[model samples]
Target chain A: MPKEKAITAEMLTKRFGDFIAVNAISFEVDKGEIFGFLGANGAGKTTAMRMFCGLSLPSSGKATVAGLDIYKDNEAIKQRIGYMSQKFSLYEDLTVKENIRFYGGIYGKSDTYIKKETEILLHQLELEAQANTLVGALPLGWKQKLAFSVAIFHQPDIVFLDEPTGGVDPVTRREFWNMIYEAAAKGITVFVTTHYLDEAEYCDRVSIMVDGVIAALDTPAALKKQYHASGMDEVFQQLARGAKRQDN
Target chain B: MKQFLSFVKKEFLHILRDKRTLFILLGMPIVQIIIFGFALTNEVKNEGIAVLDLAKDQSSGELIRQMDASRYFELRAYLQNEQQIEKTFLKGQIKLAVVIPPGFDHQLRHTNKAQLQLIADASDPNLANTMVNYAGSIVQQFQSTIFPQQQAAYQIQTELRMLYNPQLKGAYNFVPGVMAMVLLLVCTMMTAITIVKEKESGTMEIMLVSPLVPFSITLAKAVPYLLLSIVNIISILLLSVYVLDVPIRGSVLLLIGMSILFTMVSLSLGLLISARSSSQQTAMFISLVGMFLPTVMFSGFMFPIENMPKPLQVISNIVPAKWYYIIVKSVMIKGVGFNAIWKEALILAGMCTFFLAMAIRNFKIRLA
Candidate 1:
């Protein structure tokens, strides 16, 4: 019961001019669970994530991450959550080890802690050989994995991966999910947004957003059964098609 | 503070690894100093003159000899008639024409008065005025020599000594101005473009999301350039001292401190520009077009602000470089201390505070 909620949202809405990007969407994410935020492009997944990450203000709603107010305690929330942008957000000119040290330094980690964590992370990814090479020279899969590791290097309460595995081979994607599963197993909450429906099966709960509104929010199995579908893809297609029908 | 240092270290790495930025930051100051020191001199030399000696006498001959010996004029031809004078001048072959009348020697002996005509090509009015003035002075010197008693009766004696730069070398004026310009270009333009590049590359978002405050991020971007600008100042001073022979007569520490202060003002201006500009090209264009000409023209670099129109003189008062130039001229050229330059220093410090506040306010608004 104590771990039943990691995030709470009540009628969270964000608008730009007359256009509403997130329209009264609300959901809860449990602790130590992988929550999948699935949406087509322009469905406001990034905007909602930005609000949840305390990057932008919600127009007329309330949200809390790690029990901190999004408005008054944004700095506190920022210290407790980690974010890895869709755009590979590591210093391309810095080495993998240096990037880790830089992030750890900003988080006020001791130099000894940084050195130990850097060795462990590099050894875990088997990228110890590239410790001195610039991150820009690394392969895309390695960069994504390294960026994710750096994002959560300080072991925040929750890690927000905004499409962390966008452009990678299936094998690399599988490896990336393994890293995510390991982190989740360690009692860290994972909030991820992705276009890959098959990856939804890996999540403890999934939400399908269509036109700035959540059409379904439940466990992947429950969502499939509720939509009378066999998998997450059919549930998404049904929800999207239903939304399009409602729009016309 | 530790976080700020690490961020600044990363910025230095970015500047060092990028060859183009490195070249612009380090190479431009020395190159600009050399160009402004040697190539852009205002000294007029070896101007061509055509002499029409109708007297064909010793006095006229002696006047022509003195003109040739003075090195200010090279007698290109001797004109026989007024028609020839017009032809030579129209052909662009002569910049000045000296016409001595037939009765020149008789008039000097009897009436103690001689007449000479100096006609200069006015197409290039500045050079023409300089050439005509030199020619008239040479004639007056000859008249004084031949009739020292007569000169004592009707002569006006004057002694003029040019201070700071005895020869009135243009390099002495331009060296400090070029330092101001080069520092502005390197500190403001480079910082603006580099910060905009971070935004464009999406790296700024990453830095912003981290625990580093926005002010620390901006400070990190500025400190490296501040150090580099100081290095440039030293290089310019060394070049001026050894190569151009322009003296740094005041306390070196004061000159350096003023340079660093000006560099900070420029860096903050760049920050303000970068905060408003979303793209590197826009940032670069804003710094170059917005800051360059004003620093060069209105800062008393090319034209003296005292002689400028009243409106422009008032406008120049607002330019921080104008105050910096005054501070530098007072310190490096005039050998004055803080007492002599406290007013200009106060103006520069006020400008620095204004720019720093504006940049901080702009940054906050941007984040909001």
Candidate 2:
């Protein structure tokens, strides 16, 4: 049986003035799958994600998120999806508990639900002692973890993580991946974009965008075998080098 | 609405945590008010004068004595001749010199009209004009005293009643103007900077991706500043009424309602600035050079708009603070109600609507 589409795009494009940021791209993310969006710096990954999240409108083409029209039902779609940006998006001035409460409240969660979830979240992260401390005073690793947790605090159907673990220790990055896995276990679709080829291997399926176009999309193992590469890293390098050769 | 409340609560926490910002919000207004009230003034006193009495007669001597007795002029020295007048002024010791021509008493008694040459330093034109006026008033008083029977010809009777501030107290004028200025600075500039900070931090993108609508996000950001500005207005009113003895002769509720309206206008202006600026520094610059300068300069705080150049006076109409200042003065000083200040109030409300509409449109364009 074919996978159920959680997100769909058909020739979606975004342009700023005369410059095209995200060229025509078409893809779909299945429900409850970890979909990795891989791209080099300035390959238009962020722009595409922004369009998918309904923060930016496509210059042309049609897209739907969670079965709702992107343009007409953006608000409804936003309520059903979580988003974490490359920068840790939590308010640095607010405490951990306060941040959770704020995000939860914004998602229209009840006060009691927020209070209960706050306790559970703090306990799970082992950050109960630092609950009242400001987020700015926390370490970067902890901030990244807390930001991921806050993004999914409302238990949305899909969580969009835009380069979620950019700067962290290897151990912390592994631990953050465990959290992502735990969310996926609860049947939450994880739409992630990252530069780490090793991290792409952990995704159920991955898509590589090169020069505003998806050059490759498949399971990491399948992609490596098809490209005759040793690992995901070699596969990505081979695809990028092939694009450069074609341009020449 | 729940999302907006949470966003507003977060904004309050941000403001509370930033100690420097809090100090600027609460401290700058009071400091500005005190400085303007005490240190800045248009009134002049104790100007230095030199006497050049070429006619060494009793009447000239009496006039010199009268000039010395008056508090407005301080007798610096007696000049030797007309040539010394320039030297004395160049030294900067005296601002004016009285040159009594030869045979001054003889001419006054014979012709009943005497000419007194009053030369003044005109480097600072305002001070020069004031000094000249003071000297003329003193001479007229002396002439009246010397020839009371000739008052029919030299009759110059005038009654001066300084309305609102009988003593022309600086606080009476500055308190309300400071209220207008501080409210504008805190409400508009601070809101713009905070919103721009969010954009710089990349948190605004995250928030935008959430379920919150653009209107909800902007309205949330505006709420905290609106509340804080109202509190600031209260503090300013209390300070003016209690500390400066500047009474609010009109209804307090009306004053507060007008303040809130003005604050909305200022906040919308800030939102407009934030929508255009991509960075915090750019927002700060726009607020300081664009909003702050006009609020202080043309809001009847430093320079009276009526006394300004006609073009500048016309330009002040665009500044929201100008209308707020007039409304405040009418309510606080003139003891007028909405019936008298309705036009200014209406202008402020219209400006608020226009700014808010522009901000909403800009937000939509940015999203697109």
Candidate 3:
């Protein structure tokens, strides 16, 4: 049997009054694949992700998320995907368990499911002792990890992480990436955007976006070989240096 | 519905955990009621007045006694000379000085005319005006009683009776004002700030990505404040009735029904503000300066809308609080029923629909 395509886009373009925020871009991600969307600031990475997440509309494009048409089934797309941004999404005022239950509840999980998952999540994260503690009292790394856990708690078909590891220490970023790996291992497609090029090496396949268009798309090793670079960072710099847009 | 309930539960948690928000939500109405009820009253009573009796006669003495006996004035000082009147006023001891001109009992019996002058301190113009009016009325009453049988030709005795508020109590005027203010503040400001706070914390993006529709998300955010404002209305009405001694003359059901309608208006206004504002500070600023100020200025509670300029009078019609204030005053003070206030209530309902539609429309535009 052929592998399922979790997301597919063709000729996707978004314009904001004469400025092409997202130029025509085509891509595909298989089910359970970790796809890294890399770009410089203002390269339209966020606009593209927003379209896929049903947060925005494309001026003209063809796209589907989780096998649902983006234009006709925008709402259905939202149902099957989860999103976490750079800023922490969990309520700091709520306890760790309350935060988990609230998110699970909004996702239409049954009370029994939320209860069972709350226990399982607490034990998995080794936060059983601090389950009743307010999320504000938790350290930054723990908050980021918990945010990621809540995002995937609904068992979404794909989880979109936008700069999820921004501002974290290297060790915490590694731990966060481990969680992403675990989610992918469970057959959840991971669609992530990142500023750190080194993190691109962890993805199953990567696409470099420059000036609202994809300049390269391949595994990190293949991109390095094609650009004659030593690492993913050199590969990204080689493609990004040709961009015409100013820093945003 | 389960999703919405969970969302509202989360909102309640946010509100309950934040001590400051809880304090403001629960404390503001009671504080405003007390402050407006007792301290910021417009009713004047027992004002100090000096009597300069130049005529030492039975008529003069009788008139003097009557003026002092009336609850409107307190005879504080007896002045000997005209100069003493100015000195007494300068000392801030008297608001008005009554001058009974030198005359014998012969002036009333022979001439049937006597002169009386009321000198009032005009420093505080409103107080001076009221004091002068009170003293003038007392003199007229004395004149009518002294010569009841000898009726002057073409004399017109005008009887003035203040209806609804016969005692002219200031509480009757401000109780409704306080209610409008408290409900609008708690509903509009709190709703706007709470929604914008989600935007600030980055949770709004996550929420938009969820299976839950935007309408349900916005409604869930407003539901808690909607319930909170009803509690506010009940507390305000109870305080006005029991502690402040302002009567709820009309049907209690009508009052509550109209108040909930006004709360809906305010909540919709809050939704509109939240849709436009991206930050909590911006939402607060708009709610206070843009919304609260207009509620005070044009609501006909703090300021008389009839006395305003024509342009402002036109603008006042658009403020939902103005209609709410009118309905409350008519229903609570005048003891009027739904028949009397249906027009104002209709206007409020229309405003609620308009604002809610605008808010929902703006929210949809944002997604595009």
Candidate 4:
């Protein structure tokens, strides 16, 4: 039997006045898969992620995010899918514990559950001593890790992370991936966007978007072999060099 | 409800930690009240006057005495000539000059018609107007004493009483304006900045992605600001009543009710600005230059609407602060009940509904 799908998009498209951001692109995310959406700047990877997270309305096409229609009841979809943006979405002025508690509370987590889970998460990061410190004082790696934790605090059916690990040191990026892997292991579907092509190797499946169209969709091995490239970086470079779109 | 509480709590933390916003939140109302109370005034007290009394008779002496004790004038000198009167006025030692002809007593006793010329410096128009009125009233009082039962021709005995502001303290006039201004600053500028700051930081997207509806999200963001603005209202009222001696002449309940309505108007204005702006800098610019400039210029704060030109007066009707200023003045200064101010109160409520609907509509489009 085929695996359960968490998100389904058919010809999903978005336009800004005359500029088409996300062209008609169709894809499916499995229930427990770590799907990587790869693209260069303004390739419309973020736009697709926005549609899945119900942040923007699709100019055309249909999508079911976390098994709910994006158009008909996106609010219902919002409750089942967590989201983290390119910028650090947590309030920097709030303490580490405060940021966690606030996100947890707003997501309808029981107070007792938040208390228990917060303690466990703080211990796992060895941040028990700094729980009361504002997130702004934390180093880039710690803040990223904490941000990812907050994004999944609700334990939604799926979590969409748009450029979750940008501008971090190599070691921290690897550690952030480890956390992502850990989350995926718990049966939570992870749909993430990143420009770091090397990170694409870790996804169960990868899709390359060029000018609002998904040019390729397959496992890393299949995509690399089809493109006759040694790695995802080479495939991305070849596809991006052929694209006719550019935006910041 | 729990989610809203947490959202509000986080909003409070954001506001309390931001030093610049915290200063504006707590510091502006007190400073505005104190500044308006002491520095800006229209009352002319102890203004110097010179009388060129040629008669030096009983009637002129009594007229000078009455003017001297009226608390509005200080008798500077008894001028001798037309040159001395001009010199006294030019030197700025006296704001008013009274000229009594030599036949003043003879004319008043025999002809029953006397001409007393009053010359007031017109450089400062408001002061000059007040001084002229004060001197004219005193002359009328002097005439009344002379002709207690004679009923002089063309003499209309006028008994004037200034209602509400019995002493005509300028502070009474501004207390309501200050209240309106403080609420506008706290609600419009401050709320718009905080909301746009969330959008700039991208935290608003995170919250939107949560289960909370956009309406609750905006409302939750506003709850803390609403509470802070209320605190500002109380502080301003206390400062106005106790420190400045400005009385809340009407029912305190009506005054508080109007304050809440005005604050809601300000909050909706802020929501409208926040919906239009995407960055804190843009929101601050729009909120400051957009909301406040009109509020101060046309809200009847210092410039009375009745005296403003027709177009400006029409524009003033659109400013919610203008209505609130009128309502507050009527309730706090005029000592009027709800019946007298229901029209202004209705307009403010309608504005609150319109802006709120616009904000919600804009938010829907953004989400879409």
Candidate 5:
């Protein structure tokens, strides 16, 4: 079976009254592809991500995610997609098992699926003993690992992870990418945002957002060769600096 | 509905898991009720008094017995001299001193009148005034008994009819306002903090991205606090009626209904505060500085609204607790039905709706 497009946006824009936070931007992602979204602070990457994730409506744009309208079928889009923010937004007071059941139930997954999937997940992650413990007691690495597992537990078509591996040790970051690779191998589209340029090398395709517009979107190696930059970090600095000095 | 129930259950777990907050939530009202009920009454009891009876006669001794019989005065010492009386007052041992001049039975028989002096430590003006009036009334009674032939027509007697609270219990004044203050603190502070907590921890973002409608999210946040505030009202009612001897003169159902309406107003106001604040500390600060003080000061809880400056009296009209205090007093103390308190009740319900609408607007604006 031929794979289809998972995400498509055309001239998507978001404005905050006097500020055009996300100027007209557009992009597309193929199914089962791991797409890296790179941007500097205040580059409007978050605003565009919010528009795609249905957290905010577009000021003017046309977009579809998981084959559903971003404007009319926002609720439907929520069920087909998963989002994990940088803050690791899990209930610290709730036990690990409770958080799993809570997210599963919210996604409208069946009870039998939740039970069967929860057991498999606990065993696969080697967290059976800690399943009943509050997530607050877990170390940062373990919490992030658990959060990622829960975020993808419902088998979403596309999972939007906004800087998911932020603030973790290098070894843990490597292991977290292994999990992302594993999810992609299952034919789930991985749409991620990250500032760690070295991690950008792991993406199948990279889109660098500068000043609310996509300055570059292609394979990292192709972009590196095109810009004559030996590393993804240099490539990012070149694009980021261009926008800062644009109007000046 | 399932989503809302799960959300409410999660909130309850948060409430029950934190032992310190649980202690505060359950402990504060009971402690406040006890403090206001037993410790802060206006009626004087077991106050100390000293007597300086220079006359070694039957009439002087009769006056002393009259004072000792009343519940208000406890005779502390029979002073040997005026110096002894002043020293006793300085020690804080007695609030009042009654002096009988040396001519007691002889002067009463010869002149048909005896001069008596009453000395009071007026440090606490209210207590001192009440004690002196108590002593003066007892002396006047003694004089009347000793001389029946003298009923002066020119002597004006002040007939004080304490209407609702005949004994003038301060608990009568405080219990209703405590309801206002407690519900305001519990519903407003708790709901505000709970909502801001989700925002601060970044969980609100995830919830917003999920399938739950904003309305359901709001209702879910409000449900647990609503139930808890209702429990608060009942506990306060139990404490006031059984423990404090405060009567619920009107229908029990009506009091509960008014309480529920007032709590909704408090909860929506809390939601409004939560929508404005981004952190728990800011929400708590607004709840305390904004809602708590106004409820205490302008609601006529501690001071009567009639006595406040005209400007403050006008400001008091905007405080939801001001109307709630009136309803509590009317339905609980005055025992009047809904007909009498319908206007206050309607105003409170209107405040609830107005706050709810404003909170929804604020919340949606922040989300967008």
Candidate 6:
């Protein structure tokens, strides 16, 4: 039997008055797959992800997140999916443990479940000593890791990360990917959007978007071979060079 | 319900963790109550005055003693000559000088007429008016006692009685105004800043994407401030009653109910501001300029609304603090019950509903 599809978008389009931010984009991600959504500036990557997370309404077309319809079941879709943005959503004034408890509480998780999961998560992150410290006082790398842990603490089916590794050092970025791989191994699909071409090579399959449309979609190695390029970087440059929209 | 409680707890923690903001939030009511109650008052008492009694007779001594006995005036100096009156006023210690002419008892017993000159410093017109009025009343009283049945026919003796606040205490006026000002500052400005800070920090997006609805999130943010405002109201009432000697003449329960209603209106305004503002500074600016200034200017606390221009008088009707000030004065000073203030209460409830509806609509359109 074929694997279950975690997300399926058939010609999803979003328009902002006279401007088309996401124009009839089609894509699919299987369960437990690491999907890379690569795009240049102003290529509508965030706009498309917002629709999947049920934070924005689509102008036309159909999409389902975790087998729930985006239109009729927006709230239900939210329950089955988790989201973390580049903005760092955790409260800086709240202690690390308090942040976990707050996110868990909002998801309607019972106290016992949160208490048990919090200890295990804290131990795993090696942040047991800093559990009572304010999230603001922690280093940037630790804060990012803690934020990712909190995002998936409710055990959602899929997690959407928007530029989660934007300003981190290379070593920390590698460590962050290790955490992402661990989550993917547990059957939680990862749908991440980034502009870092090197990060595209770590994904199971990659899709490059240009001018509100996906230009190419395939495995990273297959995309390089098909474009007759040396690496994913060259392939991205070749696809993005033809774009009329300059980086905003 | 548990989720809502957890969210409210987090809000309280946020308030308590910031030491500077926490100090400001809790300290503002106490400081304002003390300042407005004792230091800033309009009731004039113990003002110094100089007596220029040229008569030097028994009648002059009697009148001078009467003026000095009254609480409004203190006999500070006894001027020796007519030139000393100008010198006394120029020194600024004497606010008024009473001049009893030499005609003395001869004119009063024979002609049944007497004249006295009251020279007052008009630099502060309001204070001068009040002092003159008090002095006139005292003289009239002395005259009535002296000529009990010797009044001429058809002398229309107007019997004046000051109802409610006979003494015209300034505490009775400003205590209620202070309540309105403090509640608006605490409930509106703090609530707006708290909500907008989340937006600036990006937690608002995460909140919208959560399973919890936007309505609960907004309500949770307001709940902590609602409780804090109640605490503020209690502190202000305590200070006014025990320290300032301003009593709650009406039912205490009724006064608190109306205060909570006003608090809800203020909180709804905060919600409206937060929904429209994208940054913390913008929220603070809007709250201060849009809400706080109107509360101070139009509430008729610092300035009389009737004295304002025709257009401004009409605009004062829209300010929620004006209605609240009226309600508080009625309940706290006049000792009236709900029957007297139902209209103002209904207006506040309507404003609360209107602001809350607008805020929810804007939140949906902007965030969703």
* Candidate 5 colliding pairs: B249-B335
DockQ each: 0.48, 0.66, 0.66, 0.64, 0.54, 0.64
The 10-residue segment with the lowest total lDDT in model 6 chain B: B359-368
Residue-wise C-alpha lDDT for candidate 5, range B231-330, written one tens digit per residue: 8899999999899889998999999999999999999999999988888999999999999999999999888999999999999999999999999999
Per-residue lDDT over B1-368 for candidate 6, one digit per residue giving the tens place of the 0 to 100 score: 87887788899899889889888877899999899877887887989999988888877788889889999999999998899999989998899999988877678878888889999999999999999999999899888777787868778888878777777889888988989998998888888889988988989888888888888888999998898888889988998899988888999899999999999999999999998988888998999999989999999998999999999999999999999999999999989999999999999999999999998888852243
> Which regions of candidate 6 deviate over 4 angstroms?
A1-3, B76-92, B144-156, B306-311, B365-368
| Candidate 2 chain B: 10-residue stretch with minimal lDDT | B37-46
- TM-score of the A chain in model 4: 0.97
Model 2 agreement with the true structure over A1-248: per-residue lDDT tens digits: 12367888889998879767678899888889999999888777888988888878899988888878888988898899999988878888899999999999888898889999999999999999999999999999999999999999999988999999998888999999999999999999999999999999999999998877888999998999999988999988887764431220
Residues A1-248 of candidate 4: C-alpha lDDT, one tens digit per residue: 12278988898889999988998999999998999999989999888888777678789998887778888877788788888899988888999999999999898888999999999899878899999999999998999999999888888889999999999998999999999999999889999999998899999999999988999999999999999999999998888888997765
lDDT of 1 at B355: 85
Stretches of model 4 off by over 4 angstroms after superposition: A1-3, B48-70, B75-94, B97-117, B139-156, B308-312, B365-368
lDDT of 4 by residue, B1-368 (tens): 88888888888888888889689778988988888887767788888999999998988888889998989999999998998988888888999999999988888999988999989999999899989988988887898788888864686656678877778899987888888888988898877888888888888888877888788887887788788888888898899899988888899889998899999989988998899888889988998888888889888878888998899899988988899998988988878999999999999999999999998888743454
Interface RMSD of each: 2.4, 2.0, 1.8, 1.8, 2.1, 1.8
TM-score of 1: 0.93
| lDDT score for residue B47 of model 2 | 77
For candidate 2, the per-residue lDDT at B276 reads 87
lDDT (tens digit, per residue) of candidate 2 on B221-273: 88988888888888888878887788899989999999999999999999999
| Leading candidate by lDDT | 6
TM-scores, in order shown?
Answer: 0.93, 0.89, 0.94, 0.90, 0.92, 0.94
Better of 2 and 4 by DockQ: 2
Residue B150 displacement (Å), model 3: 6.3
The alpha-carbon lDDT assigned to residue A88 of candidate 6 equals 88
Instruction: Show where candidate 2 strays beyond 4 Å.
Output: A1-3, A15-24, A244-248, B49-88, B97-117, B142-156, B166-176, B238-247, B300-313, B365-368
List the pairs of residues colliding in candidate 2. Answer: none
The deviation in Å at residue B277 for candidate 5 is 1.3
